[model samples]
Target: MKFRKVTETDVAKIVEMIADDELGKTRENYQIPLPTEYLIAFENIQADPNQELIILENENFEIIGTLQLSFIQYLTYRGRIRAQIEAVRIRKDKRGFGIGKKMFEWAINRAIERNAHLLQLTTDKKRQKAIKFYEDLGFKATYEGMKMHF
Candidate 1:
């Protein structure tokens, strides 16, 4: 397994993985000739030093997973860095193979490398499996997360 920053051509596949599941199917638009907005967002992320859009590849370099890591600098905690993981998805064929765990391990190491004081992520409550997986990785549900959709 390998983790690398996404290229423009990889956007469609990344969207596909994100849209494969039930909840994702409702939120992601993963069709061919993808909307221009996707590229625009990709460009924004690519240009930001604090954002990392990652693609996970197999031995043949096929994209099997994708995620985004954001390094946030805030006034809290004495201005320590916070690493936030988001949009995490593994290809349907790649699930149950421990690749996801490896991916999170990579993220943890990356957070450490970036001198981040904490690594955090928010998963949809509907995704019970994902929450359990995160818990198994040593994350705790220390607070209730609330969000307002615009």
Candidate 2:
């Protein structure tokens, strides 16, 4: 598998990957008339130096996974920068093949390359399997994650 920055052409596949899952079914819209918001968001992400949207592909160049990483420079932790991983999704048919592990390992190496002192991500409370997967990857559930939707 190979990982690379996402291109405009990959947005449709990424959207499909996100919408294929149970949780995503309720959250994503990928009907005949695609949403402009997705394109707008993709453009914005591409323009931001601190934001990275990555796509993972196999030998046949099929998009199989994707994730976004953002680097934030904060005053906390002695002003160290932190890398936050988000929007991680692997093709439903491609799970349990060590692809996720390889993805995380790549993300960690990327965080280190960016001089980020900490790497972090938050998964939904309903995703127990994902939580365990993260734990197996050495992530600690040290804080409560709370959010409010507008």
Candidate 3:
């Protein structure tokens, strides 16, 4: 497996994976030709120096997973950098093959490479299994998170 920055062509595949899950099915609009907003977001992400929209490729060079990593320069923690991970998705068929673990390992290493003082991510509270998976990976649920959606 290889991890690399996503290309314009990979957007649809990425969207497909993102929409494969129950929660995602309610949110993403994956299609033969993805909506322009995804492409626009991709372009915006690509333009940001601290943003990494990554895709995981198998031996055949197929897109099997994807995640977004953002290095945030914040004032807390002594002005250190924090790496935030978001939109992680592994293909439906690729689930339970240790791919997610390896993907996260890569993200952690990349964060270390970028000198991030901490790595953070948020998953929906309804995803119990996902919460367990993250806990297994040494993440602590220390804070009670609240969000407001427009």
Per-model TM against the reference: 0.98, 0.97, 0.98
Each prediction's Cα lDDT score?
A: 0.93, 0.95, 0.95
lDDT of 2 by residue, 1-150 (tens): 899999988999999988997889999998655699999999999999999999999999999999999999999999999999998999989998999999999999999999999899999898999999999999999999899999
Candidate 3 per-residue lDDT, tens place, 67-140, comes to 99999999988999999999999988889999999999999999999999989999999999999999999999
Error of 2 at 100 (Å): 0.3
Off by over 4 Å in 2: none
Off by over 4 Å in 3: none
The candidate 1 region of ten consecutive residues with least summed lDDT is 23-32
Candidate 1 residue pairs in backbone clash: none
Worst 10 residues of 3 by lDDT: 25-34
Give the per-residue Cα lDDT of candidate 1 at 129. Answer: 90
Candidate 1 vs candidate 2, lDDT winner? 2
lDDT of 1 by residue, 9-89 (tens): 999999888889999899888889998889999999999999999998999999998989999998999989999999989
Root-mean-square deviation per candidate: 0.7, 0.8, 0.7
